[model samples]
Target: MKESSVASTNMAFTDCMTPTELPAEKNGMRMKNWRNRIGLFLKPNLSKHTKNRSHRPSSDDLNQWAQSFDKLLSHKYGKAFFLIFSKSEFCEENIEFWTACEDLKTITSHAKLASKANSMYEEFIRDEAPKEINLDFHTKNAITQSLHDLSASSFLAAQLKVYSLMENNSYPRFIHSDLYRGLCVTSTAEEP
Candidate 1:
């Protein structure tokens, strides 16, 4: 596609998104504002800098994402897009911690396991850490205790809690967002 055409399509989608609503707003206006804000923020942002640039999701990928959260997480582009959308919502910690737990599980080194566990705990599970999740007291304490002699599965419960949080919360909002919806809508429009 020509740069001019791409710009116009970008404009069209941009036009459809309503302005972001304020936190004090209610009902229909909030969603309207969210769509508008996200449309602008995500505005044709096919980043040249991303590792997945070579394998950006096709319409098939978007459709697949709509089917299941697991499907979305499994797709590189879908995960990247979802991460971006989550960041916009200021809830990236949930997914970030979830990803950290995943990475932690792959470690064969006891040394690395303890090191990564402490880092993950400080980063997410600890109270008022930079990007905290709301794990229950028991779960948090158990993970904390395990930190002294951590195993790969030490963070499993906490990980599951965060996964359930995302699967039940952000995943639903994401599927219906203008960011996701517009991508699906515009991608189809561009199809032959």
Candidate 2:
């Protein structure tokens, strides 16, 4: 697959429009800001030696990522690699927004839920959000309405939408990229 494959979200193909009707993008341009890029780059590499460490991900994790998108996101090493790879593709917002939704699910405090809900909206759902994902009018409106009285489920629809976008678009590209293949190679080289 090409490095520049299908777009994760082409806003024109919102809930109201049929997939067939969506226009073929000629330039293949997507909104990507450097703030997200720089933030992701600053994190320490998970594979590097540390004073205190947990399990260093095995080649098996890299192999498993090939099996499914869920497997890639579920494994820490795989997820870290995927995030970096996605960022290179200039669509880091999709994963960042999805990760935020997953984090939101773990919160029990109503105050925190409302706060997180609004923040996710501002960052990923609002019309001019810094990392806005392409969403239809009704879905965006529905989420906005729910924010007044929110819960973990307030962003469920949006989260699922982003998840689907990544799965259908980014995940495949990551699997095909040289970075993923190199990780698998390096992990196996350490064995035997």
Candidate 3:
């Protein structure tokens, strides 16, 4: 089978594995090991439960979706829309990397920043990383250099590059996707 298909299958299987089936070990070693191996590859799907469902876009969101990539990215519904669209394209790693970087910026502790920087680089920047994102040589080299200092801005260059890639490349396709159209129709039908 193709790589994408295998990934999809693994994701499906992993999703179906309930918490009960993967009980925590007395020493936490088993759980830690399991998380290290599987968590890097398969992110839990956020769209499965009703509570986790993407917010239906408002008219303002719809208008902004057509107007600016920045606006679309600012709204949760828009983020969710792009995430679903990126998954279809098998390039969800770009958005995931972008999102991780955004989260990384909130860290105030030097120790936390150091740990997270290493983890992010290993997962998204290293060659053959599980969730390796596409990055130009300059951005990649910048990230490499930033790792030595491990500041909050360590991933900024690569993050911006991935964000621009999604905005320029995936965002257009998402706007044209049937999923986006369906969301528009559903949101429109719900308006009073």
lDDT of 1 by residue, 102-187 (tens): 89989998888888888898888889999878778999999989988778899999888888878877888789876788877655
Candidate 3 lDDT, tens digit per residue, 100-140? 89889999999988898899999999889998887767888
TM-score of 2: 0.73
TM-score, one value per model: 0.73, 0.73, 0.69
Q: Which ten residues in a row have the lowest lDDT in candidate 3?
A: 13-22
After superposing candidate 1 on the true structure, give the runs of residues whose Cα lies further than 4 Å from its correct spot.
1-54
Q: Residue 67 error for model 2, in Å?
A: 0.3
Q: What is the lDDT of residue 50 in candidate 1?
A: 45
Against the correct fold, how does model 3 do in TM-score?
A: 0.69
Residue range with the least summed lDDT across 10 consecutive positions in model 1:
13-22
Q: Tens digits of per-residue lDDT for model 2 on 10-124?
A: 4233212222223445112211232243333333445545443234456677778899899989887677777776665656788888899899999999998888888888888
Instruction: State how far residue 8 of model 2 sits from its true place (Å).
Output: 12
Global lDDT of model 2: 0.69
Candidates 1 and 2: which is better by lDDT? 1
Residue 63, model 2: Cα distance from true site in angstroms: 1.1
